[model samples]
Every structure is written in structure tokens, then in C-alpha cells.
Target: MIIGTAGHIDHGKTALVGALTGVDTDRLKEEKARGITIDLGFAYLPTPAGTLGFIDVPGHERLVHTMLAGASGIDFALLVVAADDGVMPQTREHFALLDLLGIRQGLVVLTKADLADEGRRAEVEGQIEALLAGTALEGAAVVPVSVVTGEGIEDLRSRLIAAAQGFSARASEGGFRLAVDRSFTLSGAGTVVTGTVLSGRVRVGDTLKVSPSGLSARVRSIHAQNRKAEEARAGDRCALNLAGEGVTHDAITRGDMVLDPALHAPSERIDASLRVLPGEPKPLGAWFPVRLHHASVEVGARLVPLAGDGVAPGGEGPVQLVLERPIAAASGDRYVIRDTSSQRTVGGGRFLDLRAPARKRRTPERLAQLDALMETDPAASVARLLAIDPWHVDLSAFARDHALGEGAAGRLAAELGLVTFSTPGARIGLSPARWELIRAAILAELTRFHDANPDLPGMGAERLRLALAPRLARPVFTEAVKRLAGEGRLALEGAWVRLAGHEVRLTRQDELLWEMIEPRLGGVERFRPPRVRDLAGLTGVAEPEIRRLMKLLGRMGRVDEVAQDHFFRRATVAQMVAMVRQLAEAAPDRQFAAARFRDRIEQDDHSVGRKVAIQILEFFDRHGVTLRRGDLRRINPHRLDLFGAIGEDAVNSGARSSQAETVSPDEGASRQVL
Candidate 1:
């Protein structure tokens, strides 16, 4: 268990740690000369229960950021107050910081007891009690100790041992993360970093990433709990020797996290629940500048109140933190905010959303989302979020932001019995009931569409998706449509989605009009069908009516608009592919010029024009049915059935002729000319 010391400067915090462990925690030369703790120091004591790690923090007001870094991952707190000074200014500030950090298990120590009489000791103890009133450490034991006299030191050690044994270990099931507090190069080791493991475990040879910098490194060795070990888990203070490219002692510093690479995303905007300290002179303004501290890192940030013009002193509300630079942070991580000048702590809170939007932030929907994210249990937060209007959630992003282990989201989804829709980029989850509602809504929309436009094949996929309520992401909606099609509940053809039984049938009068138009686009002239205007003139039908029917036919897959104002019969397009295959086989190297194709059409007794032949080749190129290089074109065998299946007899005949020609000794001479 890790225990951090908190008190005012020169309050004997470092001396108490030394007397208990028999090791001085103030290792810095400046701290020793000044007789004050200037930076964070560490000491460890072994007991029957386990090793108790002590993080002795600086008590000076200016170094509160350093103190917070040490206190972030501690299992217990040790509040020290000098009997002579009683509860001083730094003592109150540190106590408030501990309370804001939610450190509940701790005991207050009244030092300098040898100098203070009984009355002075009692008075200081009363001051300490008043400071703890209504806080997390209220009712905590208070011990008076003098390192010089060796009084109450043994009693403090016994109480610490009991607390260590009673302390519960943090769960190591999440992804591994350690906020690096110290990094430097050792004599023999390349680079060494030390910190308390925040979650999961790490072993020798494990590859870990330094987040925000995106540098990866391999762990060469580990010293867990101040002793050499093969592995270190959550709640253990460990030092790691890391080796990799660009991984120097300077590159990875305090505030940078060594974590699993999967959790490498960094964000600059964060939405959180913040509480303004009651001691503040006035209300927190709508836009307040502060220094934000999380884990071991500090950065500048602007706090924007989400609900109102400002938050009153001692009031709590939702707010957004717009950072000056990005930081690697996760949801549920605690953070403290101090004024930009670092003179006083302003407020502190836990992050709710890391990827908060910059616009419409105060909307009711967004506020509701922030409320749901406040749930401590990850699964409970997800459940509440899924219950919102969209009725679906991005499971992958949620897992990443929460630093969940691999496949943890999938397991949680299974536990919730949610219907999951997976795309290449993301996985979306919604309740099974919600899934059924979407399916029913899709079916109802298709039914209404078929009734209104009986001649159309179906609704466009995008249009259908837009028509549904509780709009879903495009990829997720596409996946849902695919699943419905797989279950035979709907028919998905190319870009259209429809009911399984829906079929387009032209009306009797339309059928009569199509009969008059079909003859002109078929037979010898099929290679070059007339335009809508010419067809309208020949059939004596209005141009608009003919154009509308042609468009409807395009949707029904009966005709393709080979080019602007030029529609070709689907069957004719298939036959044209067969003709192109035969010509390609006859031509040298299986590549024929457009002039040759037009000549072949003329041979079939159709006066096909040069412009029509070029349009047909361009359409084939667009659809992957033909490949063009310069003036020559070759058939793409894989796309032969792009329009519809080519006749087997025509393909076989072309294949036999090509085989005979290849076997001929004069084949090379014949291939020289087209």
C-alpha cells in the first residue's frame, strides 16, 4: 500500500517518515541544506502484512503541484501538523487538497511534541479536529510524535501497519497505465522511470507506449515495491528500465504515461463535474483561466461553465475544460485546477467526457449525456447513455476512453444483451428492443414507399436511412440493413433497399407505351438506340412522359444510361459485351480500337455511329467491364456479367476460335494486324 505525507512546510513530514522507516526521504541536497522538503521523496517499510511505500511530499505552498502528483495514487494519507504552529495556512490547503482528492483513510500527526506542553498539544489537536470536520478524514486518529525524543513513533508505525493490512488493492483488470513521476538515466541502465502502477500489470519484456508522445518501449527490468521483481501490478510502486528508439530520459518525463498502446488517444477538450472551493473570494466566472493538474502533468486550461453564467463559491456544476495543449486522459480520472498564477487551487473534479464538442455544449441533450457519464460504474454509464434518444452507442470509443481491456467491450455488450452492428471503422451497440424497433420502422417505410411509387424498384439506401427516426451513423445503418437482408426480412440490391416481396410492375397504359418503345431500341439498331427526344418523336409520346418512364426503367434495371440522354436495353448491353469479347479475340493482342468495334457492329447490319461506339466503351470503362489504353481497349474478363450473364454459346465459340488461332504457326503474323 502507498501512503503519502501531507502538511505545511517544516512540519517534520520528512523527519517522521525517516524515524518510522530508518531512511531519510529528503534526498535532494537543497532540501537537506534548507531543512525543508522541496520536492517529492520516497521511503518504504516492510511489515508482516506487506511493504508500505511512503511518498513524502513537499509541504511548501508553491510546490503543491508536486504534492498533488505524489498524492494522486496513494492508498492512504498522513497529515502532519507541528504542535508549536498548530494548523497553519499550508496545513489547511494541503488538507483541502486531500479532501478534494477523496483520500478517506489517513491519520493526523502533531509533531514537535517535545517542545509543546500538554496544553499546547491539546490545543493543536483541537485545531486539527476542526480542520477535518465534515471532510473525508473526519474522526481520523491524531498522534503526537517527536522524532528527536523517539516518542509516539512506535505507536504511529503500528497504526500504519494495521491500515496497510486493511487496505484493499485496486483492481488490475483494466489496461495497464502508470503516470510517470520520475524519469532519468541510470549508470548501467539506459532509461529508468518510476511511478505507482495505476491499473493492470506489467512484466519484463512487455512493450509499453509513452502516451501523448507516442513513443514505444520495451521493459528491460522492473523493481516492484522497492525490490527486484518480474512483474508489477496496480497498487505497487515500481521502477522500470525501458529501451527503444527515441525513448530517452528527457523524452519521457513526469506527466507522460506509460500505457498500453491501444489507449493512446489524447484530447484537448474535456467535460467534467467541478466544485468551486468555498474559500474562494467570489463566484467562478463563465470563462476562468487555470492551471489543470491530472496525474503528474500540469497544463493551462480555460474553464467554461456549462449550465449558467458562472458557478458560485462552494457550488458544483458541469463545466468544460479547453486545454492549451492535448493530454492523454481517460474518463473518470480526477483532476485539480489552480488559478493561472498558481497562487491558490480553484477547483477539482473527475473528467466525464474527453471528446466534448465545441458547439451547442449547453443543450439539454448534451447536459443529459454529461449526467449519465457521471456514473462511477462504466457499465452503468453505458446503459444510461444507450437509453438516450439515439438509442445506440459507439462501443469502441467508449471502451477506449475508459481504458477497458481488450474484448472488454464485447463482453460487456454480451452481458447487456445488446444487438451489435459492426463496421470496419466502429462497432455500435443498442438494446435488442431498440434493434427490433428500427427493423419495424424500416419495413413500414418500405411499405409506404411501395404504395406511393409502385413503378420504382425501391428506395435509395441513403434516403431510407435518413427517413428513419433516432438517426444512426451511416456505417451502422448500412450494417443494420445488411443484417436485415441476410435474415430475408428485406432485399438489398446494390444501393437500393426494399421489402423481400416488393417488385416493380408497370401499369397497363405504361406497358403499352413501353411496347411501342422497345422495338425501336432492339433488333439490328440495338447498338445505337435513339435518344429520348427521337424516341418521343417516333412513338408520338410526350418527351417528359418518355423520359420519366426511362428513369423508372433505369431504377428497375431494365436499361442503363450509357451516357447523358442515351439509354440502352439491359439485354442489348449484355449482347454488346459478347460482341466486344469476340472482337477483342479477333484483334491482335486481344485489344481492339473503337473504329474496329464500330466496323464489327456495321457487319451485323446495324449502322452504328462512331460517337455511339465511343460512348459504349466509356460506359464499360466506368463499370470495370473494359480497360482502355490510348486508342485501344481490351475486355475485362471478370466483369463480363456486369450487365447480365453473356450467352454461353457466344463465349464458347469465341474461345474455340482463339484456341485454333493460337495453335497455328502463323499466329504471330496474324496478330500483327487488326
Candidate 2:
């Protein structure tokens, strides 16, 4: 077990720790000279509970960030509140940090009882109670001790032992990660990195990477409580002698993590809860400079509470901090947000969201959600987190938000059933209850489109994307559509999408309109047909509805679109194809003029000339029946044989026409000066 001490400066935190461990914690030369600890000092206690490692952090105002980094991996905190001073600024801040870190079991040490009179001690006790009233320390035992005179020192030792024994064992069976807080080179050894092992186990020969820098190192040796061990497990304070190409004291800095390669990714974005320092200009909502500390890296940030207008100083608000630089910290990682200007410690909290999109300002509803998660259940919080976006979530992003270790995130994902993994890195979507609601919304819109325009193909994929959830853009939307299609509720056609079994059905009036417009082109040889809009104007049908009916006919292959707004009934085009093929076979050498072709077909109907011309040209083009050279449509024997004589028919028809003599579809003809 690893135990750490926390409280205000001069609260006897180091003294009380010394009494329990028999090792002085003032390790720095500057600290011993100045009568204050400027850095962390380590000690080992041989207790019946286990070989407990102790981390004594400097409790001074200026070193609180250092205090946080030292305290992150501890199993329980020994929170020392002086009997004379009661609750100081650092005392409350440290309490907030520990609680934010999710440290559940700890003992409160009310030290220096020898200096304080009975009344003073009693008053201090009451104040400490008030300070810790709603925090995790409310019901914890407050042990009174005098480290100076050794009075109650034995009692403090026993209390620490009890706390250690009662603490839960760290999980040791997953991927390994160790946060390096100190790196140095021993005379004989090349380099050493020390931190409490947070999860899994690290053996002497294991290969690991130092994060943020991504330096690879091979473990040369392992030390637990100053004795060599074959392997180190979770909750052990370990010293790893790392040797290899990238191992260097300067390369591995404090606050840098050493972790498994496959599990976590390094990120610069953070979502967190921030409490304002009383000394700041505004509580929150107003931008205040922050000395943000996490994973042993201290960075400058702008903290603004996103959940509410302002968090009164010493009050927490659901906030998103814009980091000046990236740090390697996962969701659920506890952090300290202090005022950089004053150097006075502000309150700290656990990270509620890590991959939050940028926010211009705060909102009350969002804040309430964060508050509920911070004070409530983590599992339920994750479920709510999945709802923040409309698209399939990044699983790695979710893992970082919850500060889950190793396979812990996979376990949580399996429990929620929001998605499934096809391979190690690939994610496939599923219809969780929440996603089901989104799918239903999309399907409803599709039904509306199909109902209104029965003749047109149901809403195509491009239009459907525009109507999808605003957050589901491009790639994410693509995946959502595919997933919904896989579920069998939505049908996917070439470019068209619809509900299964949605058929294009036309009304009787539209069908009668089509019949009236169908047979107008019997005799003429050229191919200009009436525009659908003009035809609809004559039939007294709405133009758009008529166009929809035409498009439906086109989809079913019952009509052909000759131009933008023109259609030819299938019967006209098919008959024109047969007539052209027969003429090409009958007159292989003849050239025909387009005007003469009109006279040959010679029906009295004035519309026949233009309509048959439209049909003849469309049929030739569709079957590769004609070749145009200069302004003339030529009939070639090769095209006649390949595409079946449509060009020959145009040449034969053009032979008798009075205007420019264009070849019939069946006859091979070239323009000749006449």
C-alpha cells in the first residue's frame, strides 16, 4: 500500500509522517535549510497491514501543484489539520482535490495538540468538522497527535495501519501504466523513474514507453521499498531502472506517464470541473488565468465555468478549461486549478468530460449535468455522456474521459452495449435505446417524402444527409446510415434510400394525363417532342406533380427522357427503332434529307414531325445508332451493323424532305452539296 500526507504548511504533516515511518521527509537541501519542504520526500513503513510507502509533499502555498502530483497515486490521504490553525486555505483545497480524485478511505490527523490549549483544540476540531461537513472526510476519524513531544504519536501510527489494511487492493491483472514523478540516475545505474504503479504489473525486463515524449525504455531492475523485486504490482511505490536508446533523466520528466502502447492515446484536450479561488477577480464564467496541474505537468489555462454564470469563490462550477498545451491525463483524473497571479491555491475537481467541443460560454443545463455526474454514479454518468453527440462516439475518447485503466473501459462498453468492436481498433455501431430514437426520426422524414412524391424515387442519400442530425456530419453520418441499413429497417438502393416496401404509386388522373400525351408522334421524322411542363399546362395538372409522375415512369422503364423536360412513351421509341433498322437493311447506299423524311411519313397531324424527330434522334443516340460529322448525322454501315440501322432510317427519311437532308437512321449517308 502507498500512503501520502496532505494539509497546510506547518501543520506537522511531515512530522506526523516521520513518527509513523521513522524517516524524516525533508529531503531537499533547500527545504532543510529554509525549514520547509520544496519537493516531495519519500519514506517506507514496515506495518502489519503491508510494507506501506509514504509520500510527504510540501504543503506550502507555492508548492501545492507539486503536492497534487505527489498525491495522485496514493491509496489514502493522511489529511493533517493543525490543532491551532484549524482549517487553513491549503487544507480545504487539498480536501477538495482528494475528493475529486475519488479517494474514499482516509484518516484526518489533527496534529500539534501539545501547543494548543483544550479550548483551542476543541474550537479547531469544530472548524475542521465544518470544513469537512459535506466532503468525503465528514465521517472519517480525526486523530489528535503531538509529533513534537511524541504524545499520541503511537495512536497516529495505529490509525495509519488501520487505514492501510482497510484500503482496497489495486487491480493487478490488466495493461500496465506508471506515472513518473521523479527521474534520476544513480551512480552505477543508468537512469531510474519512480512513481506509484497505478495499474497492472511491471516486470524488470518489460518494455514501456514514456508518454507525452513517447520515449521507449527497457526496465533494467525493479525496487520495492529499497529491495529488488522480480515484478511490481499495483499500489506499490516502485523505482524502475530503465536502460535503452531513449532512456534519459531529462527525457522523462515528472508528471509524464509510462504506459502500455496499445491502450491509451496522448491528447491535449481536457474537460473538467473548476472551482474559483476566492482571490480571483470573478468566481467563474469570467476568464481567469489558471495554473493548471495534472499528471505532474503544470500548464497555463483559462478556466470558465460552462454550467452556470459564476461559481462563488471556493465554489465549484462545471467548467471547461482551454489548455495552453497538452498533457497526458485521462477522464476521472483529478486536477488542481490554482490562480497563477496570486499563487493561492484554488479548489480542484475530477474531470467529467475530456473530449468536449469548444464552448464560447457556459449554460446552466450543462452545468447541472456535470454536477450530477461529479456527485453521483460514474456508470450512469458514462451513459449520459454517450448522449452528448448524435454520431457514433470515439471509443478511445470515451476511455480517456472516464480515466479508466487498461481493459476497464472495454468492460464498461460491454456493459452499456452502445457499440461493438469488430477488431482491436475498429468500432461498429449498434442500436442502443438512445440510437433507436434517432433512427426513428430519420425514418419518419423518409416516409413523409415518399408520401408526398409517390412518382419520384424516395429521398436519395445526398438529400437524406442534409436532414440527419446536425452533429452527424459526413463520416459519422455515413457510419450511422450503414448501421441503420444493416439493422434491416431502412432500405438502401443505388443512390436512393427508402423504407422497405415503399412503392411509387400514381393517381388515376396522372395516368390519364400520360395516356393523352402518349400517341402524338406517328408520322413525322425529326425528334423534338412537347416539353412536360407545356404538356402539363395543356392537361391542367400541376407542373411539379406531373414531373414526379414522369420521373416514376422513367424509373419503371415505361418512358424515356429525351431532354431535360421531354419524355417519349416506350411504344414510340421502340417502333422508331424497328422502322429505322428495316430501312437501313433496305437502302444501304441511299442518303436522305431530314425534310424529305418528314414528307415520307406524311400524316396530317402537325405535331407528328417534331415528335417523331425527337424519338428517332433519342433512339439513335441510346443505341449508338448515329455519328455526327460537322452538322450532319451520318449513317455508316459499321454503325448500321453494330447499332442496327437507326442512322440509315434517318438518311432514307431525309432524302425526300425539303429542308437540310439529314440521313435516315437506316441509310449510310454523308452530307453532299445539292
Candidate 3:
């Protein structure tokens, strides 16, 4: 736990820390020489409860930013007011800062009691009580002590110990992040950086990324509170020896983060809910420029109000910070915004969207999205986001936006019964309720398709995906389909997807026509079949009805029409593919002339001749089943995957060959097999 000291200069903050812990926090020679604390310093006190870290902040008004930087990670406030001077301007400002930082636990330290008489001290005490009234520190103990006299020091120590006992353990979620304030090169160690671990843990040999810059490094060693430690967790002040590519003291600096790479990607815009300090001169307007200090970094930002004309003093509203520079941040991070000209803290905010888009930020829909982010309940937030999308949402993005760890996200998702879909590059999710709606939509749509085209097979995968969620990305929809098929709610047959028990059955008239037409197309003369007009005349069916039935058969993958009207059984097409592959393999050059191919087909049916063979070859070319080089054609080699291997029965009988492999319903839908 870190306790940050805040007050006016010359309040004996450094002396008080030294008296309590026996360590001088003023390490800078310049500070000692100038008789003032100009930078942040550190000290520690050990008690039975635990080790308590002390951050001695510079109390001068000019160094309030320095105090803010140190205050970002502190657990409690140590407001020191000099008894001789009572509550001064810097003391009040420092108290305001601690309050703005959302620090709710701390006691008032009234030092230099040796210089004040009882009546004077009582007057100062009165002033201190009035100042702290209605604040988080209201009714907190006010201890008066003098470094020289050492009076009340032990009592103050006991108060600290009591506070530490009640301080809840810090949670180490969302992985490790240390806000760096000091970086330097050690004698033997290449480079060393120090900061308080705000969350997560770090260990030797762990990979860490420097944020806002994204430089990666490895931890060589670690020390907590000036002693060697194998690992450091949240609430511990740690220093790390880092060694990695292009990493050194020169490359390191303050305001950067030593962070877990998995949880971070620095960005400039931050959507947030903010409250303007009650005493601010005016409302925080849209496009107002301010210095935003979050963690250890400060950058110029334009505050764009999302919900109102302006946020009045003590008013709360949604806003987006358009930062001039990126900072390592996540949802729920606290920040203070200082007025541009005066550089005084005007308001504070918590990060809601670390990667907010500049567009549509003012829309009600977008505002509702930001509102969902404001919820403290993880399960509610996850469900809300998933409901906004009908298809699938990126799981990692959702978790990160919610400031939840992978484990937490999983727990929440499980609580809400979300179906997860994973790919090599993304983890996608669908709310169980929403997924039920999509499943029903798919069944309804496919049922309609089957009703309209009862003689045809199921719809193509791409077309079905569009029918389900046209706006959804391909990978997301693909994962959703995979999940659905795994659940036995759908079937992905060849290249089409259909409801669990969907099927196509032909009418009695179609069956009789097919029975008459099937034989003529499968006979030895199959490769060069008669035209549809001749078949209609021979079958005694009208030409129009025969044409429509033949089309239905083609859509069912039962027939291959190579020319305008010439049709062949799909089994005959498979046989032709196997024969071509055999001939190509037998040829010395591994290729066969189109003329030779046509001649071979003609050998089976003299009616086929050259034109039919050319049409088949063109069909193969359009489907990527063959490579054409001038007069010769080379088999695609993977053609068997498209049309399965031919059987001996096909080569031996009038009805030989394996049932034709269902061509992918999408591969050449626009092309007529030829």
C-alpha cells in the first residue's frame, strides 16, 4: 500500500516520514541544497500488518503535477498541515487533489506542534476540521507532532497500522502495469526502472512492453522496498532490471509504463465520464483544451462533451478526451484534467473507451454504448454489447473495452451463456439469446428457399451467411456457422449449410420425367447426349416443362450441361475427369492436347466429337480444375477433390462410376458447367 504526502512546502513532510520510518526520502542533492522538495521521493515503514510504502510528494504549488503523478497509484492520503501556519493555500489545493484522485482513506497530520501553544494549536485544529468537513477525511484523526520533540509520533504510527489492517487487499487483474516515475542505469545492471505496481504481477524473465512507445523488454531482476524479490505484485513499489533489444537508460524515461503486453495497445482518444470540480470558474465546454494527467503521463487534450452544451461545476456528464499523445490506459483508469492556461486541476475522469472513434461520438446510439461501459457489473456490460450485434462480436475487443481480464470475461460470458467462436486471429462471441434468434432466422430463411426450390439442394454457404448476417465479417460468420454445426443445429453439406433435417424431394411429375431422362444421359452415349429439345420430343413432354425440369436437375447436381442444350449425367462428368487425369499421367510431357482429349471422349461416343470435348475443357478451365497452355491442358491435380475417383463399375457398366461428388454449390454458379 502506498500513502502519498500532500501539503504546503515547509510542512516537515520529509522530516515526518524520516521520523516514522528512519529513512530520508529527500534523495536529490538539488532538493537538499535548495532546502525544498522539488521531486517525488520514497520511503517505507515496516509494521506487524505489512510493509507500507510512502510517497513523499513535493508540496510547492508549482510542483502540483509532480504530486499528481505520484498520487495516481497511492492507496491513502497523508495530508500534512503545519500547526504554525494552519491550513494554507497549497494545503487546501493538495487536499482538493487527493479528493479529486478519489482517495477516501487518510488522516490529517498537523506537524510543528513545538512552535504552537495549546490555544494556537486548538485554533489551527478548528480550521483543519472545518476544511475536512463533508470530505472523505471528515472525522479522521488529526495528530499534532514535532520532529524535534518526537511527541505524538508513536500514536500516529498506531493510527497508520490500524488503517493498514483495514485496507482491503489490492486485486491483480488485467495483468501487470507499473507507472514509471524514475529510470536510471545501475552500476552493473544495464537499466533500472521503478514504480508502484497498480495491478497484476511481474517476475524475472517475464516479457514486458514499454507503453505509449510499444518497445518490448525482459525483466532481469526485481526488488521491492529496497530488497530482492522473486516476484512483485500489485500495491508493491518495485524496481526492475530490464534487458532486451534496444533497451537502456537512454531509451527509458518517466511517464512510460512497464506493462503486460497482452492487455495493452496505446491510443490517443479516451471516452469517459467526468465531473467538473465544484469550485471551477466555469463549465467544461466542448473542445476545451486541458492538460490530462493519468497515471504518470500528461498530455494536451481536447475535451469533447458528449451529452450536453457544457458540464457545470459539480455536474457529471459523458465526454471524450482527444489527446495529443497516446498513453497506456484501459477502462476505469482515473485521471485529472488541468485547465490549459492556469494549469490548475479543473476536473477528474475515469477512462471508459481507450480507443473511441472520432465520428458519431455525439449520437444517441453511441452515447448508449458509452453508457453501458459505465456499468460496474461485468456480466451486464458484456451482455449489453453482445445484444447490440445480431451476429458475432470480437471477444478480445469486448473484454478489453470492459477492462476485464480473460478469466473475468470468461466467467461473465459463462454466466450469460454466450457461445464462443475462435479463429487463428480472433475470439468471437454471440449472446445465447441473440444466437437463438439467428438460428431461428436461418431455419426460417432456408425453409423458404426449400419451399420455392424443392427439387434443388440446400443453399450455398456464402449466400446463406448473407441471408443470416450480411453486415457481419466473414471470419465472424464462419465461426458462428462452425458453432452452429457443432451444436447439431445445422449441417454444412459440401459447400452449403441447411437446417438440421432440411431436404429436397421432387414432385411425381419431375420424378417420372427424371426416370425417363436419367437412362438416356447415363447410357454409353452419355458424354454426347441429345439436346433438351430432342429429349422433350422423345419423352413426350413439352419443351418448356422439360427445360425447367432439366434446370432443376442441374441445380440438384444430378446433371452437367456442357453446351446450350446438351446434357450428361454428373457420373459421366466424373468418369471423364478420371480418364483425362490418367491420360495426362501416362503422357511423357504430363499434358494432353485438347484434340487428343476430345478424340478419346469420341472413342466412347462417336456423337461427342470435338465440339463437346472443347466445351467440357472450357468448363474445367473456368472452374480452376485444369490449366490451359496454348493447345495443351494440365489437370489441376486437386481435381479429384472436386470430382471423386472413378470406380471400376463406372468403367465397366452402362451405369458405372461413384455417385458424382457434389460440386461446391458456389464454385461456378454463374457458369453453365461448360
Best-fitting candidate, scored by TM-score? 1
After superposition of all CA atoms, the RMSD between model 2 and the true structure is 17.5
- For residues 1-674, could you state the per-residue lDDT of candidate 3 as single tens digits? 78889999999999999999998888989998988899989998988878989999998888888888898889988889998999998898888878877889999998999999999999999999998988888998899999999998999999998899999967876578899999999998889999988788888999999987888999999998667999998888899999999888878788898888876688799899898888888888889999998888878999998997998999999999999988887787888888876447788878888879889888876787787778766667666766563345565766655445545545544565556555565566676566566667777788888888676677776787777643457776555555556556665543456666776668997898899888888778788787899998898998888888888877776776777777777778778887788878989999999888887887887887777789988877876678999998898764443443442222223111111111233433232211
**Alpha-carbon shift of residue 481 in model 1 (angstroms):** 1.4
The candidate 3 region of ten consecutive residues with least summed lDDT is 654-663
lDDT of 1 by residue, 415-450 (tens): 566667655656687777788888888889999999
TM per prediction: 0.84, 0.66, 0.76
Model 2 C-alpha lDDT per residue in residues 258-306, reported as the tens digit of each score: 8765545666655577655555555655466678877567788877656
Give the clash count for each candidate. Answer: 0, 44, 2
| Segments in model 1 whose C-alpha atoms lie over 4 Å from true places | 507-549, 562-564, 569-674
Cα lDDT for residue 394, candidate 3: 65
Candidate-wise lDDT, in order? 0.85, 0.67, 0.79
Comparing 2 and 3 on lDDT, the stronger one: 3
| Number of backbone clashes in candidate 3 | 2
